[model samples]
Target chain A: MHGKKLALKITSYCFLCLFSLFFLFPFVVMFLRSFFTATESLAIGSGLIPKVFYPKSYLDALDPDFLKYTGNTVIVIIANVVGKPLTAAMAAYAFVKVRFKGRKLIFYTAMCTIMLPAILTMIPVYKIFVDLGWNNTLLPLTVPAFFGGGFLNIFLTMQFIRSLPKDMDEAAIIDGANILQLMFRITFPLIMPVIVLVAVQSFFGAWNDFMGPLTYITDERLLTIPVGIYNKFFTAVSPLEAQPNVQMATGVIIMIPPIIIFCLFQKQLVDGVTFTGLKA
Target chain B: MNKNTKYKDILKTGKTLAALKSNITGYLLILPLLIGLIIFTIYPLLLSLYNSFYLDYDGFNNYSEFEFGFGNYIKAFSGYESKLFFKSVGITFSYAVIMVPLGLVLSFAVALFLNQKIRGMVVFRLIYYIPCLIPSIVNAIVFGYIFNSEDYGLMNTFFASIGIPAREFFYSASSEAVVTFAVMSLFGVGGAMLIWLAGLKSIPQSYYEAATLEGSGYFTQLFKITVPLCTPYIFYQLITSVIGTIQICDQVYVLTSEGGRDYSLLFYGVYIYREFQRNNFGYSAALAYMLFIVIAILSAILFRFNKYVYYEGDN
Candidate 1:
């Protein structure tokens, strides 16, 4: 029995290691190739490691045009990261603590929007933007975020708030705190972890959003990273097609921020996922 | 007695006024969300539904030429462009059917393994989940290059190293394209794996201990205790994955140029996008609605299985 158990453990480890390799292999290749010269990338029988490192590939990939795109992406991300958590928390607080008629109905209505796919509303939203002359501007991308950014964020926040003991609220109320004061002073501090979770999620969403920029931002100057990368790599029949090293380099650069955020907040992110799954 | 009655009336009115004030405060708190929902969600949904019945856009006049009575829906069903619509539906359906089950099983298995009390497990979990952090566009691009059929492609080179013939993946036949896409999507199973892990952790260890005492083997315990207990989570995953897979667009949009060879990879989302690009807004709206209905039906069917799910609180 002991020997069989040992064998099973070994088997499981082997399977896990193999699966990890599969998940990590593309990233490894992408990273390694990002430092390779244009010719080395295409050379036949070349080993995985480059013969000579070309760190300049990063610089070359982030030319002036790409820099502008990166800047645009940063603006969008900042607006989203700040706006989503702030507004979502407020909305979640209202749903959880504030008493009113039709509260459950309103909350459920917001939750139901999660089922309505974005593509279904793409056209009319686009028209709305056009009518408001908001196309080609960041408003089309960032303004709606000031509202409850996503139902998921609000719902997660509500769940977190619901988990907290109601006695805290009663204590604050007894101490002569108003509704806003109770929410902002007491409940907000308590749900900071979830707010961070929402911020992280919103940051990633804004950073990686391809369709939003693809549809709304028409000018080349106003393009975000994803759309810019698509145009740079995929759109043109570029002479750089042979130099996929540079393309990979661009991808690596764009991937860096999100990876850093993930590493920095790994615990919160895992906890967030666990919280969503278990609670839901 | 008159003075006392007047005082009582004043107290009653004060209480009513305070209630009204609280109600107003509640409304004020949720005002931003209410406005957002109306503008971004509710209005757009209604407009899209209305637009689905119209045909053609007058770009100069800034109005959609109305074609009443489901003309756009008919076009999607029986018009000349219906070929692409139907083909995309067939492709998306197969992709979802294959991808959802494959992803769930793989992630669940990974979760089971990771749940073991092994050293360096956190590192393994992070490594597995790193792919999920990468953007879908970047994921698609990286995979596209890796699976590129040409000479410099990684898959072809690896196959060559092992003395196997290289297969054209994305450029291959329809069935092959579906499999290739599904396989690429499996790279981001980390999210689902995390959920599964949470579900696994939530199952009480006492159940396993009792099973062991009763002479139940590991596999028996897993099936009898762990699997049944995790059904709620499994059900949740099923519904979400179904909804997500039905609306998949980004990867297909990035990987394929001009809708792949003979539009073989034209997914429903991509087809809707193309219709919009062609200024066929009404037809695209109809397509979106059709996709929505299909998702709704699939979700309804899956929700039926919720009765079998075991919740710990129920007992």
Candidate 2:
């Protein structure tokens, strides 16, 4: 048994080390790409690990769109922070705490909506936005968040609300606390962790969302980071008709703000994933 | 006894009405959510379902002019779109094949490494998570340079240092395209790592103590104990991954398939997306619905395996 244990430990260590390297290699490659030089490209041996390091990749990435893209991303994020979590929390509070006629039936119907793939709704939703004349506006981008339309948010809020003790709600009701008061005063404070979860998630969802902004926003001035990155690489009529390195530099810049935010909230994020029944 | 009886009797006459009041609050609570659902969601869903059954193209114009029938489904599954449908199904299948198992194994292994009583484990976990938060558009750009035909890639330089010939990793079966995607997916393994960590936390320390007393070593404890306990976690991650990969777009759409590589990187969701982009809405909805069906059927099959799962504390 002792010998077998020793062999197993070694195998576990070996497997773990190999896996870490596998997961780490792409980041390693991304890091190296950030440092590559044009001088090395002519070296016939110029590698991603530069013999000469230049800050220019970072420099080049900070273009005219840098501020514009960053500003747009920030606006959406702020809108999402205010809109997504609060709406979802209230809605979730309703689903869990409130009891009404046909309540279960209605909740079940909403839950069934969870399985309707967003891809299926893309065209019709876009058409609705277009017909409403909100297509080029951030209204299309940020408005649905106000009502807990994103079921994932609703689900997370449900989990948080489900975990709270029921007695507090009973006491509040005895004290004549309205549903809104019970939510804002009692339930919301208790589910702070989930609120944090929803905020961080909504921020990232709005931040990293390429397809949403791509499908909806067509104006140059209103371009979000994801769309900005694409425009940098794929712009047809521009003189810079697609240079890979410059585009990557833009990628480097685009990745930074969210990366920083994720670092700060990685703990909640991990917890949030597990707590929300992510696997199920 | 007096207070209890009085309290109980005080509300007796109004019991049904009070119950109705609470229920009304519940209805009111969900009112906003229901409204949004009807407008932004259910309405759109019905519209898509309606659109899918029609013939709508330039030879057809827009929604105002299109004729409704089973013609769209016919066009979708007919011989003309058969190759498109099958190719998409095949591509999505290949993608899931590479992604689901790969994500599970990689996430498991990385989770184990992080779980180890290693120095700086938190920082190490954080380092691994950086790529996941970078967003796919950024990921695509950086990788495009890293694998730009191997002529300018870091890997090529690394290979040349070892006397190996420079290779076009993308166009070849050593397929840089797939490699890029796999790399991108690895970054998002943070979610998976957390699940494994939760599983790790849920394990009773007493189990390890007992194993040690029986002269079992670390490996026996891990494989015989930790890994088995973690099977449920592994199973969950695998299922979500299977579903996620089926609807994958955006990363491939905004990233690679842009540069005349249309036919090459043509994924199922991406193919459907292009149909929409080209104003081929009818065709796109059909494909999206098909994806939904495939996902539902497969998830049901996987979910059936849930009976075998041994969740702790159930007994």
Candidate 3:
């Protein structure tokens, strides 16, 4: 039995290591190739380290237009990271503590929209934005976040709120706390972890959102990081051969914020995923 | 008797007033969400359904010129558009069929290993998760560069180093495009792995002890104990991933620029996007409805056949 256990442990380690490398391969390649000279980036077996450590790619990637795009991305992320959680929590609080006639009906209706494939609504939403003249502006991306946030965020938060003891709410009510006051002061503080989860998720969602920005914002000046990077690296109009190193640099830069955020909230994120799975 | 009746009526009116006040407050608190749902989700859904009937695209932005009929839906069903639509739908289904199971098995295996009490397990888990943390667009770009069709591509380079011949990936032939994407799906398996790990952790250690005492080996325990217990998690992953993979647009769009050679990578989402970009609002809206129907039916079927999922208390 001891020998068999040893064998199993060894096999597990081996498999884990191999899969780790497999998962890490693209990031490794992205990191290394970003520093390579233009030709070396395209070359086969160009060694792990670049012949000349190139900072030119990094410099080129930080051009004024790219910086502006970064700003645009930050604005969108901030709008969502703040708006989504706040509104989602408010909405969640309503569902959990507040007594209303249509509360169940409204909550279930909102939850049902969770199954609605985003593609189903994209066209009409696009038309609505176009008709409103909100197209080509960040309003298309940001304004809706303030409304209800998203159903998923609200759902996640609602679960968290439901798990809280109801006495806290009852006590607050007895103390003459208004609904908003109870949410902002009592429930919000206790549910900060889930709120953080929603905020971080929102940050990543807005950050990685390619299609939304790609659709609404046509002006080059207003492009977010994803669309900006696309026009720079992957478009036929702009040849991929122009700057492989720069493309990788920009890609690496774009990946850093999420990685840092992930590391910071790693435990919560993992737990949150599990929580969502079980509850959902 | 009259005075008593008057007091009772006053009490009744007071109670009703309090209920009305509470209802108003509740509605006000949730007003943002209610308005958002109406304007964003409900309105768009209905308008999308409504727009599918109209067919008029002459490059002008005038909605007044649009003719009312089912021409857009009909166009999608009977012609080259029909061929493309069904083919794209078929390709998407195949992609889902290939990827969902692949992801489940691979992520489950990884999660099982990661769940073991071992040194450096956290590092191993984090390494696996880093791929998932990479933004999808960036992942697409990185994969695009790494899987570049030419000899200079990173994978091809690795093949050369290992004495294997270079193979064209995602570019050479339409046959390999979907497969290439299915293979690329491996990178994002960390998300599912996390859920699987949660499922594994929830399984009581006593079950394993009982199995061990019965002289059941590792494989037996895994198959009989761990696998059965994790079925609910598997069910959830299946439903979510099926919906997700069917809506695959960004990766194909970002990687190939236009759905690869022969439109082999043009999944339904990308097709909808392309039509939308081309200003075929009615056609794309119709296509969007079709996708909605497909998803709804699939989800309904999955939920209907969820008897295989084992909840602990069910027995």
The candidate that achieves the highest DockQ relative to the unseen native structure: 3
Estimate the lDDT of model 1. 0.83
Clashing pairs in 1: none
TM-score of model 3's chain A, to 2 decimals?
Answer: 0.92
For all predicted structures, in order, the TM-scores are 0.95, 0.88, 0.94
lDDT of 2 by residue, A1-280 (tens): 6998677667766765665676566666556655655444434556556676766877777777777888888888898988888778777887888777887777777777766667888778888888888877888778877865467778887887787789998998899988778888998899988888889888888888988888877787888888877776666563234644455566666667777777788788777766665334
Those runs of model 1 whose alpha carbons end farther than 4 Å from true positions after fitting are A1-5, A44-47, A239-242, A277-280, B1-11, B58-64, B161-166
lDDT of each: 0.83, 0.72, 0.83
Candidate 1 chain A worst ten-residue window by lDDT: A234-243
**Residue B286 CA error for candidate 1 (Å)?**
0.7
lDDT of 2 by residue, B163-261 (tens): 877765444433345555666566677667767777787778899989999999778998899987876877777677787888778877765553124
Residue B147 in model 3: lDDT = 77
Please give the lDDT score at residue B27 for candidate 3: 89
Model 1, B1-315: lDDT tens digits are 999989999998997787777778788978889899999989988988877777654222344346566777878778677888788888988888888898999999899999998878888888888888877767766787788777567888788898878878888755677678878888889989988888898878888988899999989998998899889889989999989988888778888845678787888898888888777777788888888887778877987997888877776
lDDT of 3 by residue, B170-266 (tens): 8855668787777787888998898899899889999999989999988999999999888889888888898898998887888776667788788
In each prediction, how many residue pairs overlap at the backbone (N, C-alpha, C within less than 3 A)?
Answer: 0, 2, 0
